[model samples]
Target chain A: MAGARRERDIHAATLELLTEVGYDGLTIEGVAARSGVNKTTIYRWWPSKDALLGSAMVEADVLAIRLPDTGSLRGDLESLLRQIAALLTGPDTSPVVTALLGAATHRPELGEVVRRFFADRLGRELPMFERAVRRGELRDGVDPATVMDLLAGAVWVRALLRGQPPRPAYVRETVDLVLRGCTS
Target chain B: MAGARRERDIHAATLELLTEVGYDGLTIEGVAARSGVNKTTIYRWWPSKDALLGSAMVEADVLAIRLPDTGSLRGDLESLLRQIAALLTGPDTSPVVTALLGAATHRPELGEVVRRFFADRLGRELPMFERAVRRGELRDGVDPATVMDLLAGAVWVRALLRGQPPRPAYVRETVDLVLRGCTS
Candidate 1:
């Protein structure tokens, strides 16, 4: 129990540092100082700074996402995309997420963690498509993974690349467009 | 002519050091050493490291993209996306682009440059959609900008976020899906 509590403290400190300093400026030493955990302990648990930050992101943020099932794929997708947009645009998470994204480009380990995090989130949302397929809202063989990528990826571009907030109307339109493509 | 040659050498050296050291470790001093140019001259033209690198990216690489007009929206989009995929996955440009992306998160000026770079590319491709609309291949009121974001953003996610190469087949399918969404 003590170990688990200490791990939580480390994750919290990691996130705090990420938000304050951004990814490029972040270091294990800062995490150690902030968390009051020895640098050696952090190193023992996480092989590198990338590993610790990635793990902290998964533990504190990514895994917390819950996709709403509104009894229809479109409804569920809209809800989920909205949530994702909110998360990305939120004050605390936005900077951290953006930093992690930038860091992932240069670091292979961080890239692996990021991919796994998305895979897990996408995996959880797969059942929404399955239910839609059963309901005949989507054609057979419609890949839920691709749909997730399209929806989430569209929002990502607007939010991250364009520096625009993913508004409700825009998310709805994107969902409609993807649903139209899948259904027709 | 000598001045132009010196500028070209600087851009080349910048890309080289960007690839070798990654973005965070890169410095104007290294660039000057690699290019045999004075640091003061580089600073005279570019105010900061971000400005210099962003300028180098624009001059040396981004302006090289060329999209073939296959006389159909689908054909043109597929060709453009394929080119984008290849560019992102290519060794020479990928690291530079990735580093720029990460750097942009912390630097608003770099972010502006990145946004303008994409916007310019998208603007260059908008005529293809216009041609399609005139040729009756697309519905009236189908927004080219949104379509661009959807298509390019999807590829970006697959390439950057997922660490998956944007294969030709996948690019084609994405185009087909988006076209279907817009048309039907």
Candidate 2:
């Protein structure tokens, strides 16, 4: 329990540092000082700033996404999109994602972290369609990626490309219009 | 005609250098050497590297997106997606766009360039729905951003998040399903 708690603190501290300083300004020393974990202990598990940031991203409870089996496609999608918007556009994590993406564009290792982060998050979100399938709400053979492309794509473009904070009206309208048919 | 040709050549060279060496590697001197444009003249027109890059992006022939009024909603969308995937994922301009985005994340000045680039490009693309709206093929008052969001989001996410090159089948299937009805 103590080890688990300490790791969470370390991850939290890393994200906090990332948010405050951007990617280039982040240092393992800064993470150590912020987390109160000794530098030697931090280095034992992670050898580089990239390694530490990757671990923090992959292992963070900051991504507390709860996938609800809302028994219908619409409800599940709304839950999923709202959660994603909150996570990606929220003040705390938005800059962290942006900084990581900037750093990841240049570094393959950090790129893997970005890939894994999306894979994990989108993977968890994909199962929301299962209940819809079971209830005949969605077409049986619908490609999950298609649905993801529309929902996640809309969310990302709205946030990143347009630079708009997530709006409830936009989210609701998108859910209604974007998911009219998960059938292809 | 010679002056216009010279400017076009400069923008082309800037994109080539950007794709080859990336953002940090891109330099005004390199653009000058590549384009055969004098550094003093380049400096006279654009004060800094960011200015050069921004001008090159905004004023380039690289984004030759022709919004054809194919006389139907589906036809227009398919054309739009196909062209975007080709331009953004094509061998020449993809890395240039990627490098610019990474650099723009931190620098607010460069950030304005990115915003303008998209606003200009997307602004042009937005009128694709005009034919649909006029033809009564799409719902009246349909938000053009929604349509752009679904289409562009899929394209960008495939390239950026999933690391998959755009597929023709994807472009077609997404047009079929993603744009089923723009009315919300």
Candidate 3:
């Protein structure tokens, strides 16, 4: 297999087993078994469990969220939120993240990784808000984190707390609600 | 201890142990040992671990959130968000809920309890929004769930995802944003 493909497989396998057995039970050998990639290859590419977890988590969450550039800010926000809603209700609910978060409450190293990973992911969404502000869709001085949090947070509240899939209608309303709040 | 105080202590101890040892490790005896109540007394009330956990989780999350009616919708919301922010950033960071939620993805019984607990908790906040709409503070037909998920979700996003405290200012901004969104 190609090197990039092998890396993708390894990361995918790592997350798969991570969700299944949790962070504590995850092993490179299991990842190798799942991915059919060599454990030695995984170690050679990523030196430690933290390194592997950090890379996989960042790759999965940040890399997957492509900021859609719809002509209007509403379109852009709606598009972005729809993707996030899907991820939140989809495979992203893997207990591994929850299990890791649960452990991160106690484990500082894991906690730091989880924190940095989300900070980076959340930060990446800032450009969308900046664009909206530039286009006069959002009021001047609107904070991206605040907007993003309200938007994504709505999806999360439903998915995480309620365990409900945030349907398409819900996504549209959330975008509309947040946009109105920010612009008006 | 009196009946109410004893029950409170039992729930407190149950949540404490649930966070420390998780739902799997939690037991009636453990609650008894921690709360200074006898196992027989605990069983006489709760009957099973699920029953005990159901009582404790609901008591801790729902019963703790007292919606302050500060006359206006804005004040009431701000007060409510402040209390929720405290809980989300405070002791509510207990891994037991996360652990139970994670387990709920696979275990049906646990899943129902967790879902019902949050639905009931979320549902209890509706009167505030109803009052707001009645007072003309919010637009007619504003869905309480949407507003609430935005408010509480913002807190959860900061607390759970970023591992950061939802400061007073953040809580205030969230209420402001959601209120503006709804009213405008």
Candidate 4:
């Protein structure tokens, strides 16, 4: 019980530091100080600062996402994307996500962590596309992975590269565009 | 004459250090040492480390890209995206681009620089879309900027998030999908 509590405290502190200082500036010492956990405790759990930050990011962004199935491909996509937009633009989560993306570029292990995180998330969401195919909304052999990449990628570019909040209208347009392409 | 040579030497050193040490580890003193230029000269020109890095990235990536104007919309898009894929996967430029992107997250000025760089590149490529519209390859009212975002965003997601190189087949598929969506 105490161990679980300590882990949560460490994750919470790590996330706070990620948003506050970003990945480049984030350090294990800062997390320890912020969480009031001993530095040795952190080292025992996570061998390096990158490992800790990667875990914190996955815990914050990936684990918590629950994809909605709204009985139609368009509905499911729009709903899922809207949730994504909110998360990407969320006050607390956006910086953390951006920091991880930035860190992933320089660090190969962290890149794997991020890639695995998304791959798992996309895997979880695969059923939505399968359902769409069953409903005759999508053609057979349509690669759900590619479609997911396009949809999510479109939003990510806007949010991260363009520095624009993923507005609802933009999300709708992206969904409509991808759906049109997939269906046709 | 000497001033131009010094500037080139500094930029070359900056790019080299960016790939070697990354944005977080790169320091003005290090750049000075690598280029054999005075630290004061770097400060005189760039104002900050972020500024120098941003400039180096732009000089490396943007100024070098040449968008192909292949007459057909499909041809133009495929060629352009292929170039993007090569650049993103290129050993020398990829790290610098990634570091700049990561640095841009915490540094607003660098973000603006990246944004402006893409915006300008998109602007240069808008003529291709316009030509396609003239040839009835696309609808009259299609927004070039939005289409550009979707295309570039799809590639960026794969390259950055998925840790996958944008393969030629993937690039072709993206172009076809976007074209299908945009036309229909």
**Which of the numbered candidates is closest to the native, going by highest lDDT?**
1
Give the alpha carbon lDDT tens digit for every residue of B1-184 in model 3. Answer: 2399899899889888877786778889999999999999999888898888888878764337786888888798889888877765554543554556555655667766777887877778878777777677776546678878888788877876777888888888787777665221
Which sections of candidate 2 miss by over 4 Å?
A20-30, A38-52, A69-71, A181-184, B17-33, B39-52, B69-71, B181-184
The per-model lDDT (C-alpha) reads 0.77, 0.76, 0.74, 0.76
**lDDT (tens digit, per residue) of candidate 2 on A101-143:** 7777766666766777777766776667665666777754567
Model 4 steric clash pairs: none
For model 1, the docking class works out as acceptable
Give candidate 3 regions above 4 Å deviation: A36-40, A60-63, A91-106, A182-184, B36-40, B60-63, B91-108, B182-184
Query: What's the i-RMS of each model?
Result: 3.5, 4.3, 3.9, 3.6
DockQ, computed on Cα atoms, for candidate 3: 0.44
Using all chains and alpha carbons, the TM-scores for the candidates as numbered come to 0.83, 0.85, 0.86, 0.81
**Tell me, what's the RMSD of every candidate?**
3.9, 3.6, 3.5, 4.3
Candidate 4 C-alpha lDDT tens digits along B1-184: 1387787778788878866786668898999999999999789899888777666655543336786777788999889888877777787667667767777777776777778767767778888877887777875446666667777777788888888899999988888777664221
Better candidate by lDDT, 2 or 3: 2
Model 2 per-residue lDDT at A43: 87
lDDT for each residue of candidate 3 in A18-97, tens digit (9 for 90 to 100): 77787788888898899998788888878888888888887753237787888677887788888878766665543554
Give per-residue lDDT, candidate 1, residue A73: 75
User: Which digits, one per residue and each the tens of the lDDT, describe model 1 over residues A43-103?
Assistant: 8899887778767867774326776879877788889989988888987678778777766
**Tens digits of per-residue lDDT for model 1 on B23-126?**
67789999899999999888888878877876776677543677688987888889988887777888767877777777777777667777776677777887
